[model samples]
Target chain A: MGRTSDAKERILSAAQALIELRGYSALGVAEICKAAGVPKGSFYYFFNSKEDLALAVIDEHWAGQRGNWQRILGDDDPPLQRLRRLFEATEADQRAGQQSCGTVSGCLFGNLTLEMSNQTEALRERLQQIFEAQVDMVEEVVAAARERGEVTVADTREAARSVVAQLEGQVLFAKLYNNTRRLDALWTNCLALLGAASPGRAQEAPVAPAR
Target chain B: MGRTSDAKERILSAAQALIELRGYSALGVAEICKAAGVPKGSFYYFFNSKEDLALAVIDEHWAGQRGNWQRILGDDDPPLQRLRRLFEATEADQRAGQQSCGTVSGCLFGNLTLEMSNQTEALRERLQQIFEAQVDMVEEVVAAARERGEVTVADTREAARSVVAQLEGQVLFAKLYNNTRRLDALWTNCLALLGAASPGRAQEAPVAPAR
Candidate 1:
């Protein structure tokens, strides 16, 4: 039993790394098993198919990410500050990823959404649920900000969606240009999206556009 | 001569549709050729490899999209209104795509960036140029808006990047949810991002947050 569980762990870790490095449709079970250092039979024993393995990877990634999000968003900081922390944390994470991988891997969910969502109903549904949950989490913070009169947006849900969308979009650019600095604009952009006045240094920099 | 050019056009069209419906990696030369109803010989006659074909697709799509963007952004409307028109055109495009294909096939460049940027330098460079051109076009309009005191953004380039990012992000949601309605928020979000006081009826809606 111990050995069997160990093999499963190895496969999951290897699959997740490979999926992040490349993508789902480009991967094969044989390549995943080879990278995992497990035999072909071990793969079938653990996953019914490559899609099954992808679902496991998605769930595992979201579990960790959701925990991080909840901690940051649910903290004791003022609602807007908490949102700032979320953006800061996101940039830090992307920077760290670039350091380790030599290139930003981008949001796994966003990557998969573009690559595999339309190809598989299972992935599409799972990605939809995950994004909805993300929007829900952001909406909670925006709602809190609204109650405190920090934000003037009429629709917290739409505001939250736009914020998340901005994050994904900036991350997409970061990955494309291989630059984490692309993420630096998130906090200011977030504040603007919610119509809240910037608190310090006005977080809203009005420097001349980069020539 | 006409027959040869016709075959190439067919291959390009088929590849773009397939790339939009699925993605680049999951496709094979033979499959694209089969879908084009052209012989595999015709494919190799026009393109060297799948990567080459992808570059052609990217270039071809950009050629047409760039023309549309120039027309809309260069129109005689107020700078902000041109921006508004761009967003509305985008939403209408997505809606038409959803209606025709039963799913919202997102921005082809964005979809490819998330799916292929890290895997290929050639693709990364091409996608970077495409996005930069997009930002340049938007920055022109934004600078015009700034000169008119229509927006308070500090950096027109950064503001433009954020705007493009928002568009990519919203389109991702539109594709993931398979719903074009997700794009309806683009114009409102654009005004917020630019810090421009929305004109007429105040595009800033302080309505109740969606439940």
Candidate 2:
């Protein structure tokens, strides 16, 4: 049982790394199994198909990412500051990815959305749920900030969407140019989108993440 | 000569359609050739390899899109209004795509940026140049707006990048949700990002294009 479960974990890890490196469509189960150092039978024993494997990968990635997001957004710092820390963490994450991979792999969800959304209804639905959840998390922070009068927006939901959209867009550019510095504008852009009082570069000093 | 050129155009159209429907990686030369209704010999005569075909497709799409952008951005309207029209056109284009294809196909360049950028240097450079051109055109309008004191952005280039980033990001959402209405927030978001004085949803009433 231990060995069997270990094979599943290895396959998942290898699949995730390959997906981040290339993308979903170009990947094959045989290649994934080869990379995972498992046999072909192990793949079918675990995943019914490549799409099923992709769904698993998406769920696993979101589980970890959601945890990070919940921690950052649910922290005790000022609401706006928490949002800022979220952007900083995102940039840091991309930078770390670039350092290890020699290129920005970008948001796996965004990459999969562009590559696979139109081809599979299942993927489309899964990606939609993930993005909706992301926006929901951001909206919570925006709502809190609005309550404290840190930002001025009539629709916290739309404001959150714009902020999240900006992050995805800048990350897209970062991946395209292989330059993570492109994301440095996220905090200032976020403040501007929310109509924060100090929506100037002068106010965009990076803050240490609390916890 | 005319027949040969016609075959090349056919291949490009089919490849673009397939790329939009699926993506570059999952596609094969024979599949593209079959969809194009062209002989394999014709495909080889016109393009060197799959990557070459992709580059040609990128160039052809950019050629057409650049013309539209120049016409919209270089029009004799208020700079901000031109920007607004660009957003409207983008939304309308997505809507049109959804009507015909039953899904929002999204910006072809953006779709490729997320899919192919990390895998191919040629594609990465081409996409980077395309985005840089987009930013340049937007920066021109933004600089004009700044000169007229209509927008209050200190760095026109960075501001333009942010605007384009917002665009790509929102388009990412629009594609993922398969809803073009997701883009209606673009003009308002743009106004906010540029720090325009009247940045409110009430001010986002759609305006007809000035040709």
RMSD of each candidate relative to the true structure: 2.2, 4.2
Q: Please give, as one word, the docking class of candidate 2.
A: acceptable
Clashing pairs in model 2, backbone N/Cα/C closer than 3 A: none
What tens digits encode model 1's per-residue C-alpha lDDT throughout B1-211? 6899989999999999999998998999999999999999999999888999999999999999999999999999999999989988998998998888988889999999998999899999999999999999999999999899787778889989999999999899989988877878888778777777445311245222343
How does each model score on TM-score? Answer: 0.95, 0.94
Model 1 quality (TM-score):
0.95
DockQ of predictions, in order shown: 0.62, 0.46
DockQ value of candidate 2: 0.46
TM-score of chain B of each: 0.94, 0.93
lDDT of 2 by residue, A93-210 (tens): 9999999989999999999999989889999999999999999999999889878877777788888888899999999999998988888888878877777754343223211111
Each candidate's interface RMSD (Å, one decimal) is 3.1, 6.4
